[model samples]
Target: MQRRQFVIALTGLFAAHRIAEAAVNPTDPIKIEKLVLSDAEWKKRLAPEAYQVLRHEGTERAGTSPLNAEKRKGYFACAGCDLPLFLSETKYESGTGWPSFYNFIPGRMETKTDFKLILPRTEYHCARCEGHQGHVFDDGPKPTGKRYCNNGVALKFVPA
Candidate 1:
């Protein structure tokens, strides 16, 4: 093969590999559902932050979550559905205010592009009920190379 043609072929192969690695399933449509809570019941159930992020798609300030320093064997549940989504073993200190996990229990969460801050970010919600949780990122401890950074307000940690 000609040198120039060989380089072009190699470049195409590399690009294909990267694309395959990055491909993820499209999130299901956000389905609107009636709240399963009475007004007083929801108010009593969630904190202010939890209400905003889980019910209203709000983001919390970075580096402010106590979960960043949390070190315990447990499962993290969606504050919305109470569904288990992450293991404490996957958690990491991403210094991003929320709880950062390297991976999730597959198919437990979904994503959409968030333009709330004038920038595009991949925002994820609980797959069970489509409750807004938080964003995922490329910046994370390796192996999976995914930072499933979740809003501390959107999760409730349960000790094992």
Candidate 2:
């Protein structure tokens, strides 16, 4: 093979390999198709915070989530699908900008690395509609050792 051709082929092979490694599980490609809502409809359906995060992919101010102190028996549903993602029992105080939960209802979220903060963060979005909720961090009380920090704007509290 010519030197230039060999280099091109090698580069293509490397690029393909990198792309494959960067992809998440095909079965869990952050399914957000189910959560799309009309702007006017969402305006009437959601509070300002919920609408921002669930629809517009906005983030709430850190330490501003009332859910941080929320300690009630209820279900936390997606602001988009009303799909239950976390139970009240798993909720905890992470003192983060969003609600923190130790556990999820299972298979209800998809996570991707976020670089908006100039640091790689595990940003999780609702699995049903791909709404950006918040980032997950490792600093939390243990059982799962995973803090599912969620934007209060992306969730709806349904009291049980």
Candidate 3:
């Protein structure tokens, strides 16, 4: 009985820690000031596909983004707020049919837990606009063992 109580207490502490970490403050260095917009305004400013991906957290079909074949030297910015998120240098072929980057521009993203698939996953969004970009996974190339699997419709490529 004592062992079971200890296990439960430990689990509660871990859950509390996760909750605290997810509650990022606006004043945190990693959190950019937010840009709040009405649904109508967002609809007006973004394309139909971008609106769905950025605002509604919808995923674009894999292998459908021209960015999958993008090879030019440039940066990927959020489709919603044009906030530069990833550099062209960080991109790599993950064979996941989505735009994959190993790293992002510093202080440009915020992460939270997602349970949409009935399991916990780290979901990242643009720090400036809170636009849903994609999920980050542990499998990635050297330098940063993190793959930022982004939805193409949520990004805009800007040539550097």
Candidate 4:
């Protein structure tokens, strides 16, 4: 009973906040400036593999990412628009065969519910370009308890 009430309260609060936010600034999308581009330009900007994942919201093969072995201190950026997505410090070996991060740089990405697989999952994308990055799950490290399962082809690692 308490759990259900708490959930209902949280949902109501979230809806109210979103409504208030829209009333205050309806044009803003998640507080970050949006970037728009032509499909032809996106194809020219990204490689074949990256284009499919970032632009078309496709997933890459698991465990095939060279980024899985990347251990240097740096940040991961969107392959499509070069928007920084995750810092090296937030990354962890989720052992799910993909490069997983505990969190992303705040406001750098946005999320939507994905129903591609029968069960709905949260899908996140680069806020700047709206390029698909990956899905985030609750099973992760202590600090954030989030696993940002990113596609290697959708990201570019930038050393700090």
Best by TM-score: 3
Better lDDT candidate (2, 3): 3
TM-score of predicted structure 3: 0.80
Once superposed on the true structure, which residue ranges of model 2 sit more than 4 Å away at CA? 1-33, 38-45
lDDT of 1 by residue, 22-56 (tens): 22311223232222433454556688888778777
Candidate 3 per-residue lDDT over residues 43-82, each given as its tens digit: 9989999999899989999999999999898788788876
RMSD of 4: 13.4
Write model 4 residue lDDT over 1-160, tens digit each, in one string.
6985676556556645653453343234445445565688679878999999989999999999999999998778777766667888888899999999998877788899999998999999988679999999999998989999999999888776
Which candidate wins on lDDT? 3
TM-score of each: 0.70, 0.69, 0.80, 0.79
Model 4 stretches astray by more than 4 angstroms: 1-31
Clashing pairs in 2: 32-129, 32-130, 62-97, 63-97
Candidate number with the higher TM-score (2 or 4): 4
> Each candidate: what lDDT?
0.72, 0.71, 0.83, 0.81
The ten-residue window of minimal lDDT in model 2 covers 22-31
Query: Taking the candidates one at a time, how many backbone clashes does each contain?
Result: 1, 4, 0, 0
lDDT of 2 by residue, 1-160 (tens): 9986676567556534532332322222233334344577668877877778877768888877667777878778776655567888889877555688988766778888888889899988777667778778888777989898888768778776
